[model samples]
Structure formats: structure tokens, C-alpha cells
Target: MPPFGQGVSVTLEHLFDPGAVAVVGASDTEGKVGYEAMANAVAFDGPVSPVNPSGSGTLFGEQFVGSVTDVDDDVDLALCCVPGPAVPEVVAACGEAGIGAAVVYASGFAEAGPDGEALQAETAAAAREGDVTLLGPNTSGFVVPARDLLCSFASGVADIPAGNTAVVAQSGGLAHVLAFLSRRQDRGVSAMVGLGNRATVGFAETVRYFDADDRTDAIVLHVEGTDDGRALLSACRESETPVVAYKVGQSDVGDFAASHTGALTGDHALYAAGFAQYGVPTVEASDRLLDAAAALGDSPDPDGPNVGVVTAQAGPGIIIADRIQRAGGRLPELADETRERVDDALRGVTYTGNPVDTGRPMPEFGDVVTAVAEDDNVDIVLVYELFEAALGFPVDALSGLAGRVDKPVLFATEGIEEDMAADRRALSAAGVPLFATPERAAEAAGVLARYAGLSDRREAPADD
Candidate 1:
């Protein structure tokens, strides 16, 4: 059976099309969810109509309707920002009007108390009955960066840039934060979906969709909890797309058992075991999320465990090499040819062994990179440097070396301040990945190597 549901597949392109949109409960007041959504839609260069029973005219120079039933033109999406009690009725009207999807932004759902759960259930049932796909009952909604379309009420939409990685986050706030960080790091997003309470759609379905999405190169998930562990695991295991996840709600009770569902499923150990069994990588920190996305998105799967360390300084280089070894990455013995090249580049003062360190004030830094990168034993290369006034290391030359070499190169620099921002930008644009600390760089490399090893084994079902 196919991993996705039987409903019509919704593409990112379909979701962002500006030809048709309806904003329920749209208001002229600022800071309100409906008002913000309509304003964003208007700015998105799409056809949008505001629905408000109190008004008979247009909002933001577009026609206004009192109800979804009044809309004569085709609407691809209905952004419902109505109160929880009124959501079901509005959804039913949209279904009768043939609206394709409903982005329900109201809160009072399963995440709330029992009454909220009933309200969410009624809204979801209405969506099913109306044949409309519901995005959330308490969600920031979706954004398609390439299209410049934003349907979410998230205040941070102004910063996101269009790119290849798509994020599906369960926490509405974290979803917004992820989008902000992506933009801040210059990593673009193709699409973002915030699954609030997940009454109808689940994380597994989103993963299946992303696997088939041609624009998406990688997927990051922020999961709080889920109803069906086995089904989610199965979907991820079957997908060829790389899956990275961060699990929250680790303090909740009954987190490990199969019988536990919803908020009770917060056991960190059980989730870790499930992720390992299915070949899904689980990350803890937010900073690592960005690093993992960058590394996995660019580099090919590792061919072997061998890693080469190239540094302008001795201390940082030694630190990274030791960390790599501790993290399970091998530092193979340097080849004779490589050692000879290093010797010629460094003269006789510095050691030319594994973790090749060229002496300071070297005339040609590019040559040093080429020498270390060309080594036969190196599967991955870690470059560490410290930016200072007296030592003007050839960053461009190092980046050039990165381009020519087939192996993955990770760059780490000390003294990260506003002064080094330009150099960081240059290295980043040149496709030489940068990390703030040696430990983080090595940890990221270790994670990548571990995933590469797992990828070689026969894939297992997620629930196992």
C-alpha cells in the first residue's frame, strides 16, 4: 500500500498559487489572526476575499463576503481564523463551496483541555465531511518561499527566504523559530507546515509528501508526540529522503509504551531507540539542526570512515582530531606522498603527519589545502583556523581547495565576532561549511559518519 493517504496529493505549488484564496473572519484591526493572514495574502500578489458578517465592502482593496457561501469565484484555499466554536460551521460552508484546503489557525483544540479536544474533533470531522484538508486548529500554518506566499499568522514570515529544505514542526512557536533561523543562516526553505494538535494530518503523512516532493532535498521534523509510532516509523523507513527529527515533551509520563498515545508519549529513550531502528537521525540542539541540514544537504554519503584534519593552528587541529576519534571517525595514517607534500609546504619547523599543521606566515595557503585534500586516506577533511590581524590566512585559497576536492570539508574558526562576519560569508558562499567550535564541528562530522554507516545496512521499519 502507498504510504500517503488516499486523498488527492497537495503540492507546494498548489498551496502557493495566488489565483484563489478566502480568509474567513478577516478584520481591519491589526494584530488579529484573520487580519494578519489577509494582509499577508494581499502582499503575496494573490486573489483574496475577506469574510466578515459585519462588513459588506472590500478589505485591503479586495471584495469582502459575509460567508464562504457568498464566494462565486473558485477558492483553492480557505484560511479559517474563526473562533473554535464557529470553525466547524465555517468549514462545512467551505466544503459546500468546494474550497480545496482550510488552514485552521484557532487554538482551543487537543492541546488545550477536554472541551478543546471535542471542539477540535468537530472541526476535523467537518473538514472531512466537506472534503477539505485541514492544516491546523492551533497552527502558524504554511509558507512557500519561492512563491513569496505566506498563509501563516506567524509574525516572522518577513525574514524567511525560499530554499530546498522543508520543515514540518509540531510546535507552532518552534516552527516560527526554525523559519527565522533558516533565514538568518541564509538557508532557504521551499515550504513549512506547522501541525498544531494534529487532529487530522500527522507527521508521517507529511514525511511521505516530502519524499515525493521534487523541490525538497532534505526534511527536518520537530515532533512533540504522535498517536501511531509504528505507522510513522514505517513511512520514514520506506522513504529514500533523509529524515532528521528533534523530539520534545521528554518529561511527560507513559512515553515509552505502545499503549501510550498523544501527550503521554514523551519517553526520550524509547523515541531514541525507535529512531535508531528506522535509520532516522535524532538531534537535540537547535544549532545542530542548522549544521546537520547544511552538511547532509550538500555532501554525498560517506564512502569510508577515514577523516583528514587540516588546520592553520596546532591547538584547534589537535582538538578536532581527538574529538573525531572519540566520536567514532577514523584518522587513517597519512600516505607518504601526502606527508612529502606537507613537508615541502611547511619547510621543516611544523609536523607533517596526520592532522597536518602548516607553520604560521606560510607564503602559499592554497598549496597547503591541496596537499592535505589530495591524500588517498582522507574520506573527509576538517579545516580549523583562527582569524587574527597579523596572520592573514588565505580563506579564498582554502575555499578554492574545498571546491576542487571531492571530499566533504568542514571549516571551524575561533574569535567569531562582527569583524569575522565577512570572512564567514565568503567561506559560506564558496561552499566551505563553517562551524563555531571544534567540538561541534567534530560532533557533526561524527553524526554524519554514523548515518553513513547506518545507510549501508538493510533498512528497518520505523516501529521496530
Candidate 2:
């Protein structure tokens, strides 16, 4: 395998927030990839110029240049929308033009056969010789929701709104999937990047960069595989910000993963173990990864593994308890005083223990939750309640309690989607994360407790 970025300066800032962007092979044709790249690049919060070796024409209000070097203004990033065989020259020309970075949207590199591998190595050499950072050879590109910057050619990705979470994935497709899922959850992302083919930049570099980024509160890493595990471990260990990882390639798909990203999917068990040792939580599914990162990012670090479950209905509450406990979370018995308070609030009509079941929505549902949230043994509170038009969400009560308490409180509910919109917004404004299902809420609560346990383990002194 050929080395990458020997002399190149890899500045993620240039890749993420470039001062100017050039879309090489830009086209005015609506259906062309070049056209889509141009359309998205124009939305960037900087000067966006189109570069085409063909005849120049006006598209998206920007005049096309014959070459990147021909452009009068300096370009910090170039979207190489050209073919694989054409990438090396593009990188060299971009370097000669003083462009700091370039994103290769072309495929058929290392992921392809031997000839493609040679092409990838050549592309890497050109990038290194040019001292330019490269993002991908098979990437769908990235999006910065806050800046309204769309560095990708993929559709629907441009609509992702800005939020506190940053998603970095090995697959551009998966990255966009998580972004859209976040949007569906009414929670968006700060930035979403795909490390496709990883011609130069990989997870370690991206993680370290996002760790120092103030815009990112939490990072969700989607790893298919990697050869440089130690670098990733160090980066995750150094991050004070919360990180949740989703590792794929669990089945007998190592060869497929290798063909996909040019990196062999190493032992999945080793990856999980190393991630745990480095204090980073790992999840298997994409939704779980997003939920964990969202909960950890928005909610306070939980103090312990004890979760207080307060449900308006018994069935969903039972489901939440099962999921949380299975994920290593504890539903501790409520303090006697706490149970008494819950009983008084619920009129002894339902179970008032750790997994407190309110039976149904009632006037004092908020008080029942408050008692559990304030319990001495409850370090995290998980509440599951179906929306009732008459009683509605306990927004005011939970918001007030969350404001005063230092623990994590998660709310899960199912209701008429349109009707719950306003309350959902209100809860979001209060810094409370609301899930659409009992299992999701419980999974998020379990993530909180797992993170807290990791912290405790890290802080504990070594055995004598």
C-alpha cells in the first residue's frame, strides 16, 4: 500500500469551511454530477467559482474558469468532479494554484482492482507532492448545516439543519442516512462528513479536528474498518467531548468492507474492546449511535448507572426497564420518602417503585416524575408517557426539574405527530431530549448510564 500526505498540510478547516471553492469539471447541465456539485458549492458562505477545462459559461451566477490556476482569486478547496484517471493532474494543478485542499468525488481508486489501487497511490503521491489535503476518492462529500455549506453532490443532504452533533462515517451513504435520521428526530447535525476511500484524511484526523471544534458538542463515528486503530484510540481518549461509535462488519463481510473502503475490517471484538478501554461508548446500530450521541451531547453527564423510570402506562414502562437493565443500567428502588411522595401524587393507583408506572396520564403525572427525578438513588431518569390531548406532556414540570437537577432526564412518547410538535419544540428549548418510542428512550438512558460508568471506571484508582 502506498503512503499518503507525506508533505501535505491537512487542515480540516479548509475542507470544512473553505474561503473559496472551485468545482472542477463544473457543468451547466441540470442532470450532471458537475451541475449538482456547482449548485451545492454556490450555497457555501464564500466565493464559489466553477472550473471547467471546456468552454466557459455562466451557471449559478458564477463564471467558469478554464483551470483552477486560471482563476484570479485564491481557492482554498477544490471539488474534483472529474474521473479517476484525471484526479492526479487535478490535484497537481490545484497544488500549483495554492489550493489548500481538494475533495475527490470520483470512485475506482483503491476500492477497485489492482489498476485502481495504482491509480489511488498515484493520486495520493500527487496530493502529497502538491502539499494539499484530500478528503476522498469515492466520497459523497460533506455538509456544514450552520454555514449552509453543502460540499456534497448528493440530494436531500442539503436540507439537513444545524444542531450540536457531528457525524463522521466511513460510508458517505451512511453519513447521510444518519443526518436524515437526525432530521427525522427533529434533531439535526452540526456537520456531517464521509471519509470515503480515505485517500488522505481518516477517522483519527477528523475526530481530532472535531474535538477542538466549538460547534460540535458530540461526535458520532461510524467505522467500517481501519488499519490505524491506535491513532483513533488516542484521538477518542483526548476528546473531552462525548463520542459514540457504531462499528459495522460484525458478520462475515470483512471482504466486502475491504472492497468498499480499501481497509480490511479487522476483528470487531478488538475494536469494541479498544473503544471501551479508551472511554468511548460503542453501539451496533445507526439509530442507537445517534441516540446515544444525542443524549450524551444534550443532557448532563449522568452521575451513576441508576435510572429512575416513570411511565404513564405500565406496558411501555416495562419495556423501558427491560431494555435499560439489559444494557447494564440499574433501576434502583426509590428511596422510601421518594416512594411516599410518588404515592401521594398518584393516589396509590399505580406502582410507585423505581420503574414507577402511573398506569395512565393523570393530573399529578408531573409530580410523580418529579419525585422520581429527585430520588436519592436515581442518577438518571427515564420517563415514558403516551401523549394525551387532555393531560399533554409534563413540559413545565420536567423542564423546571431539569433546570434544578444535575442528572439526565429523558422523555419518550408516542402520539399524534402534528399535535405533539409544539410540546416537542418546548421540551427541546428546555434542553430535554424527547424520543418517539419507549425503546429509543430506554436505549438513550442506558447510554447515559454506560457513559457514567465509564467515567467512574476511568477515575477510579488502579488496583494495588
Candidate 3:
């Protein structure tokens, strides 16, 4: 049997930085996929040629061609806005036109049934014959904010500015979900791609490509499942950049997941075990996936699973400590010297154990945090303090401490957005990720610890 889609070239640069694009099924009607695809494509930094046999005149400030072969300019990518039945022909036409890449926006193949699967096979065959790299037969396309490229039809994606995070999701909707969540959290992504149906491109190809991408610092994978899980695992294991994953279909959603993207979504427990063995940090919730990515991308990896937490309020600290311990992290007891220093700083005002709760945002809170972070036992530090305009964030102290320490220092706070905006930026600029919720911050810390443990296991010598 032919090796999976004949291993067609999925050169990400060509797909992402195409000099010019062709919309194979461009439409003039509002709300149509062709129109929206064209609408997004015109924002590209290069020329966009819309192709439709019946298309005429200009739409979205681009001239419409009768076919892909008719376009005079060299096109690197084609967005097949046509229906499922017409996609193979369009992909074949793109290959004939020397276009190296295409994104098929149509559904119906594979997930629909055996007939659809046959059609999907045909689509793949056409792509292989044409030497064309296909993105999807059922996908939402992709976005490269740094290049001012938005190939997806999804709105609000245009505003996701250039950043270091890269999202590789199996489902297009989930891709958008992570992108929008990142935007909402004021986090930007270098690129976000949806691997739909996987007629050609899948997790391994995309992950390996992004792993080498200089623009990407962290890669987040939203996995339902794949037949090529081993390849995906290999890519993750080989990636120099940090990779975080969120695998769904943990329950009886296997059929639903398969229908969504023709994924296997086999036993969730097996996937979890495989991911753990491969050293990829897996998150449970969708939002937490983005959270973990941002955290891992921005913060330094911990030396061990030992975390030192300093909270101004004991209640929230308890919540954070509980969640941290539950997530495979340890709040180890502070060293004797560390406890003494914290005691000296807090003046015995509150708990001085591993959590080191101060009861309130006291003046010496920063000093206590420093004491805990400086402790040799603590590999990571998590700080929580409510917004007290009077006390303000320990920006100067925390920034200085973070700069000095080799480990990660994460902050968790809740306050009026307007009031904390400047401090948030300051902390972020200092390489500290400030989460809005205690759970989110704690979870971020837990991921760092989890990854550290995974790394330890990976590097540990196997028993003879």
C-alpha cells in the first residue's frame, strides 16, 4: 500500500508565505465560503488571483480569473472554495498550473461515509499526482499574523497579532477557539493551523515544520486522534521548542471525533500514556491548553517538580496549592534558611510553610517571595496577590528577582482590568506570566513541573 498520502511536500513556508494566492472558487455573494475566503486572502502581502469559471469583474479588490491555469502570475497557493465534488479537479488544475499548495474548504469526504472516503482518496491522489501540498478537504485554513496573512474565513482572526505561540489543532473550530482565547488573554500567535481530514498534511508534518520555525517559540497541539500517532509522537520528541497538547475524545466521543475529522481518537488512556512517555505536556481543558503553552513558551523550565508558592491571601493560596499538588507538582517545605528569611520578612504574621501565606498584601511580601525563590529546594515560584492599588504589584522586586533567578517566577492576580493593565504589561515584559485566576496560574506552574519531570524521565538511563 502507498505510504500515507504518498508523503506529499507540505513545505510550510510555501503554504504560509506564498508570493501569490489563487482562490479556485471565488464568489461575489455575501456570506458564501468563496467570498469569505477571498475576503481573507486579499489581506495577504502578495497578489491574490480569484479563480471561478463564472467569476467576472473584481471582488475584494482582486481580479477574478476563469480558472487556475488562466492566471498569468505565478501562484504558490490555491484556496479551493468549491464544493466537495469539485475539489479534486481544482487541485488537479492547481498542480497543472504549477501551484505547489492548496487549501480545500469543502467537507463531506471521509467523515461522511465510505463514498466520501473514496472521494477523499481521489483528492489525495490528485494532490500527489500534481505534486501539490493540500491543507484540508475539511478545514478552516490558517493564519500567519506576522506575515499579515489570513487564509482562513474565520473573522476576528485577523486581529491576532504576531507572537511566539503557534497552534496546530486537528479541528478547525478548535484552532479558532485557541486563537480567540489567546487574543482574549492578550496573547498573540505567530501562526495557527487547522489540519482537517488530513488528506495530506497532518500532525507530524505540521509539528516538525513548526519545530524548525524561528518565529514559533511554543507549539500547542489540539488532538482528537490520528492514525499516525507514532509519527506525531516522534515529532514532539524531536522538537527543540516546547510542545503542549490537549487531547479530546476522552469519553465515548470516538465516533463523533472520527466524523469531525476522520480521526481514530482511540482509547484516551492510551493516548495519555503515550503522550506522557513521549514527554509532551498534556492539558485537560481547552483554555488550559493555551494557558500551558503560553506559560511554557514564556517561562524557564524548572529544575525539578518542587514549587515554592507565596500568596498574600491564604484562601487563594490553599486553592493554588491544592491544584498544584493535584497536577503532579510538589509544594515542598522551605529550607531552614529560607523559612528564617521569610519569617524575618513577614514578622510571623502568617503561615510560613511551603505556601508562605501572608494573610494580606503586606509591605514585606516581595521580600518573602524572594526568600522562597532563593531557596535551593524550590525549582519554581508561584506568587498570588490581590489587586491593592495602595500596595500595587511588587513589580520592581519581582522583576529584579526574576531577572536574577534562573528558574521561573509566575504571578497570579485578580483586579480591575483598567487598574492592573500597566503592571500586567510590566510583569509580562519582565518575562513573568501573570494569570487572571489562581487556578490558571497554578496550572501553568504545574505544567512547568510536569514537563520538568518528563524531561528527567527521558534523560534518565534505562535499567540494564
User: lDDT tens digits, residues 314-371, model 3?
Assistant: 8899999999999889999899999888878877668989799899997888888888
After superposition, the stretches of candidate 2 with alpha carbons farther than 4 Å from their true spots are 1-9, 456-464
In order, the Cα lDDT scores of the candidates are: 0.73, 0.86, 0.86
Q: Provide TM-scores for the models.
A: 0.87, 0.95, 0.95
Worst 10 residues of 2 by lDDT: 1-10
For lDDT, candidate 1 versus 2, the one ahead is: 2
Per candidate, the number of residue pairs that clash is: 4, 0, 0
Candidate 3 TM-score to native: 0.95
Residue 154 displacement in candidate 3 (angstroms): 1.8
Candidate 3 deviates by what RMSD? 2.3
Q: Scored by Cα lDDT, where does model 2 land?
A: 0.86
Per-residue lDDT of 1-464 in model 1, one digit per residue for the tens? Answer: 64234333433333444467889999988999888998877666567889889866778898889888788767878888889889999989988988867888887676666887788778877877877777777887888777667888777685688767778887666777888888776676777788776666677777778878877777888877665665666667777777777776566544332122224555677778887777777777766676666666655555566788777778877888898887768888889988877777667737677777765546655576777778878877777777765545467676666446666777777774777777777776776767878888886676666666667432643334
